[model samples]
Target: MGDQKGEVVGGLLDSVRDVAGLPECRGICKIMYGNLVRRIKLLSPLFEELKDGRQELGEEELKGLELLKRAFNSAKVVLISVNQGSKLYQAFHWDKVALKFHQVTEQIEEALSQVPYEKFDIPQEVREQIELVHAQFKRAKLKVETGDIQLMMDLNVAQIEGVDPAVLKRLSKKLQLMTINDQNKEGRAIHELAIASGNHGDKIFEMSSLLRKFKDCTHQDSLEFDSDEGERSPLKHRSPVIPDDFRCPISLELMKDPVIVSTGQTYERSSIQKWLAAGHHTCPKTQQTLLQTTLTPNYVLKSLITLWCDSNGVELPKKQGSCQSKKPGRESGAVDCDRTAIDVLLKKLADGKPDQQRAAAGELRLLAKRNADNRICIADAGAIPLLVELLSSSDPRTQEHAVTALLNLSINESNKGKIVNAGAIPDIVDVLKKGSMEARENAAATLFSLSVIDENKVAIGAAGAIPALVSLLDEGSPRGKKDAATAIFNLSIYQGNKARAIKAGIIGPVMGLLRDAGGGMVDEALAILAILANHAEGKAAIGLARPIPILVEVARTGSPRNRENAASVLWSLCSGDLEQLKEAREIGAEDILKELLECGTDRAKRKAGTLLELFQRLDAPSPSSLEQKSDA
Candidate 1:
């Protein structure tokens, strides 16, 4: 028993540091060794009997030895868990952690193989505990291997797909994957093993409490905060009551990483991240199930809190949330931070299985939305093609998520070329025709962003996206209409695209928008009509539709920008065309133009003068025509 204690049990505890280069696990080794040494010191006069050539242990000694071995072995299991978990602070090393899990499980299985309880007739309860540890290990290993596959089966909504090799290579850089379920399971298994060991179970590791030790531990990258009063420093003084809006409902403390879930409830980013990381698909406060996990940073709320802190002398929350870019004007550090993270997420989005890909899509969308820099990094990492591929996915929800991501990326002007080169226009066009209403709206919005480039405008125009755009303007929701109008305005900048837009019959519907459009939509709708009216085909459509009355009213009452657009379209219609002049006169445009000329700015007055001058020239009768009318 003494030799077993010195060699096998001691060897197991010492091997932990050697097996992994984790600095976090080093402290636990000392605690495990101390526990072993204290247990060993309880025995006395053992060496004297062994030196006298006593061949076997007495009954009491043998039972004590079995108990000691079990204690050391159980302590070894706890140390292994601490080893695994301390490195699990960030998801960046999950692959490494997974390998460690395999090795540690193998190590425990080997150690458990040494306990010859059946041959030695150890106590039944102790034997049962050891058996229980083995069973728990098996259960944990099984869970790690199969959890992902099961999750995929549960969430997979379409046939398996094969990704393009070139696209895959572009995005296949290994990144830290988020693996909450597996990590939580591993922690649980070790905690259960420690409990079954009878004595070692109550000891807590450094940050996470095993069932008894790690209760209510909050983990951050490279740091952990203990919520328990006994675990933390003694409270010196109570602070002021934090504003209810400032506090996260999940943590009920100050929101450090303040993020808003789909339900519009705000929680600390870390708390919500853990909730999502644990694969729960509902809000903690409302219990309303979430369809998509998009945690937008509540930057306004954060700003208010910062201002409140400065004004009241209360402490500001730590700058832990991804959105709270603490250092402004330091572009290099921000870009460097974003580049590595975007690479990791892109890799996961490109190469991971269905559930992982979906999760990565949702996460990438959220991150890209946080700031312009993140979007630039995501686009530069060749995320465009992978997102384009996801856009073609058969799953409706996946399609919307992919569309949302593409829309986010397309906001960066540089990503347009990548998306266009990948021929995303075709898929996006398909989405406009067939996707869900939200997907359709997002697709149209993406098209608006993409068509801002002159080259992409021609490409989208060639892809026959104009008809779908026109249809959206006619029948889509309010936001969809605005997006479509913006896209048409961008597309109609070129003369050929104008012809294409006119061919799609955009003039009448666009005029309908001009009549009642509010907010930014008013300007965009007016611009499309003005561009269309410059062409002969479009002028006839607008003249026949007879929106001159609406134009006259808008030129008089709309915002300055809208008035300018309205005046320009009217100028195109009325200049040198007697028929258009007649339409303008019948709609009382002359009087409105006269009023605008008196009160309008230089641009509006210039346009009104041009219209009024054309009306004067068209109204003047020729001398020969007047003489002929007098003779008759």
Candidate 2:
């Protein structure tokens, strides 16, 4: 009989742990079940107290354990139900879920009250914890959270009254559903709930209606947004992408009347007005509280947008609520405009005179830098071949503009392949070696951007860009050195390029930067060394530079990220190299390791802990010494 009671208590403890291990509920469901989860987790330690002493329990205590087990089983059901339910459904039907919480709380409280502590072998701490949990459940049973009730009422009103934006702003804040990512998560939950409910209910209908209204007020509509002209124009296929800066951050549509808010972020006048009317006292784009809510007209951006529209043949959007606005799909004029502009520039590069080529290259550079869409447009217009041709032009300024344009265009991921396939690496390398300083800086930067593609790392290395990059790092201007450091860091990520970089004499410049405390390149230098330290030859070169004291100083005093990277580099240096480990210990790295173990970033703390353990292990007597001590 005692054995059976022990087995029962052990099984109940397992059940309690399982309930405590369930994932906590989220959003409105979290508000309802959060306290209940806490209560169940508190009971885990209480059950643990009974695991070894289960045989000492009498029948009455066994009955109490059984009662608590039943209550915990009930809790597990409720937790699973809420975690799997739709956030929207939970928000709308919060009262029904709250009832489940109230009932489960009462059941658990009653079951805990029956556990006679004096009759059992449980500790005083476990008894007190269970009692505290019982009292909490007792209070929770009668407590009605007025705020949760109000939130539920707001959600219902939104479902019935077509979503007042002011109420929506309040709901969004209360529910933590502010970002687009949050809305998408709720949408997925709603879809899952609809599928589970077989899609035929008033509740699903209400949820769908509320979500639709919420999205319509928040997200951008299609190109036909506010325009009433519904005709499908033939030019719909050629509608140009609007520049992101010209569009309202709120509505994501072209701003007819741009206004600057207190935060200096610009938005369309109507969109800002609607946001203010919705009782939002903060900027939509920045979320900063408004100082005065004054809308100052941004004449400069308005003029630039107007000039762009005029040059691209795109129609300017009309004032809010005005008739005769630009028709949707018919305003594909910008598309045609960009195509024409790019073709004319390409033609100038191919056959125009020297001045025309330089001017055209400069224009293409600005166009590529303006926005992502323009980068695509410029590259799609077949400008890479012409630009590569100009990389070696005898005219220095034209070469500068040409390489810089390629640099800007390479910001788009797809254009990396295009630039490489156009046979630009050798020309870019040539410019890096011999062009004017600014041109060489940009050429190095261009190589860095292109080398982001892993395959280009090898090609750029084979084309001898590493030597030129090393030279720039050693002798170029401040900006040039930074660019070269970044390019070398990226190229050296490949196994083959690490050797090439070492052969090109990268260690001297890197060591110089490390030793120069005021050079502002310590971060970049240490970052590159951290990567290079993993390679054998590169590691040997860095080791010969005698980097322990400097690295220890950095680990002791650098900024958080710098300290983290310094720790990483130190660990790489000392991991398999006993001489390096002894050198670090001798140079006072042990005290810094202890400091880092306490206050460093997570990765830094981990590396510091491993190094500290290694140091301790080294300090401990060996097995042979221990045996000798025993003999003595």
Candidate 3:
């Protein structure tokens, strides 16, 4: 029992010695044996006493060792007294202040470092706040590192708490001095982060995109608002008015190719002027303002009137006021002479001077050829009868010019019967048989124009014009041959004249002219042959004489125009006679017919097809024979 008590007493002594050695207090102490020792003067002694079976310590015995252990273990109670005592010591000594601050900084850093960085999913606003906080923390850290205590103090605790760990690490120096306001901390942080990341420019671009979106949104809103307003909005309620017959009522499309009518209204050319003049210009459906302008006669109407006057052999209005000024100058004179030549010509005509009359008439004929209007005026002024009389003259030039002038006057179909009645055809034919190339060509052209009318064709054919034209084909000039061929072609278009042409022995010469110097003559001759081939008398004449060789040559080696005409002739021949089918096939007509059928004009193709069909039908075997062969 004494040994255990002694052991407990020794343990209590060691605990008291350990507590006394702790540096809980600061003081001057003796340096004994190179070790500084604090002098802790004990005011009480150790003693032994009994109280409720607990031992009481006696004076000067160091009996409070167990109580010291208990107090030290109860740090909350003992730390308050220690802090109070340290504050009192610190008031008297500034050296301990630095050490206290160092300890405080170490504690704060350790606590901040322990904060969990990865625990929370940061909202955008919270993330921004953290960025701002980090920026502030960096600034504060920089200032604190440079020993700017005032700046460090200015930084708030909230700023440090809000700082994102990543941002805090990135800009630790700037973040160190920043203050965070709880109210606007997130916004400020976002702004700071945006500035640091150079996203401010991107924000401006985003603002522009937002403005555009706003504009589109506003437009849509306005439309909806307008629609909601219903009829109150004029723009929403009103529709553009258009006419029922909005078309030009002329062209029936929009108003183009406009012309005026006598009813004082503008309409497109497709509108009938006469119908408009008769008060039919307005739209049948809508009586809106379809009138575009005031009316005037179209130029074509005047042209048609002029054409009518010229065609009927009527004289145009003479330039009366100043004949000399209005008359073409001597340099522009077609006759290569003056009015003196006319006087001389009139004298020769009166005196019956054949050679002189012929020369003067030839001059007039040359002038007339140069001016068609002059020829018409001369004919209308009764020069035609005088020229017809000159056709009986012995001089060929006299007869030639006389016939030429007469031919010019006879161009009008209305004048054709009259010219024939006046014995003009025989005179013209006589001159054509002996006339110069120019005279013959002019005669042929005039005859051709006249032959367009069926009455003129009969009159001319009756007056023996076919033989004279055919004679010109044999001995005429290139132009003469062409004109003669053309006239013959025109004559053949009339079935009555076709028989007459054949009876006049004109068919052979007309076919011969197909190989003439002029390509036009060849085309015209082929055309005449084609026309003749359509008539029974003409076909009989062609079949007996057979112009097929000439036509075949033209088809094979002629110009496209010639080939076309040749094809037309072949078509007419095949249409008139099935016997010509074998002949056509023998001439390699099948291949040529196919080419024309595919590539020729519509008319040519139609004719070629007809010919091909005719050939096929003619070549087809009898059904009775086929049936018999099948039965066998």
Candidate maximizing lDDT: 2
Q: In order, what lDDT does every prediction score?
A: 0.61, 0.78, 0.50
Global CA lDDT computed for model 1: 0.61
Ranking the candidates on TM-score from highest down gives 2, 1, 3
Per-residue lDDT tens digits for candidate 3, residues 1-632, read: 33433433454444435535555432111011012012111200121111112432333222233333232223222222233221212222323343333343333233223323223233445445434433332232211223223223322221343333333222222322121221123222322222211212233223222222222333444567678898787556322221212223322222323455433444444334322222222332122112343455455644554454466554443422354475555334533434554555666766755655775676566554433345444444455567778878776657667777665455333455556666676666656666767766667766765665566677777777788888787777776777777677767666777877888787777766665545445555666777787787777787776766667677766665567667777777777566676788888887777887887655567777887887788778899989999999
Candidate 2: list runs displaced more than 4 Å: 1-337
Candidate 2 lDDT at 513 equals: 95
| lDDT (10s digit) by residue, model 2, range 1-632 | 57757666777777767766777555565655777877777877766777766447777887887788778767777777676545677777777777888788889888888877666677788888777877877777545577777787788677666556888767765665665666666665664343222212346556655665565555433334433335554333334556768866555557899999987899888767645542334566544346578999999999999998898789887765563354343235443338788999999999999978997998898787655568777887899999999999999989999999998888766788899999999999999999999999999988987886778989999999999999999989888898898889879879999999999889989999988989888878997898898898988999999999999999999987678778888888888888999999998999999999999877789989988887888799999999999999
lDDT per residue for candidate 1 within 75-151, as digits (tens), equals 44444544443221212233444455455555545444544435433445655655665555444442233432332
The CA-based lDDT of model 3 is what? 0.50
What are the candidates' C-alpha RMSDs? Answer: 22.5, 31.2, 53.4
Model 3 RMSD, rounded to 1 decimal? 53.4
TM-score of 2: 0.49
User: RMSD, model 1, all Cα superposed?
Assistant: 22.5
The residue pairs that clash in candidate 2, if any, are: none
TM-scores of the models, in the order given: 0.47, 0.49, 0.43
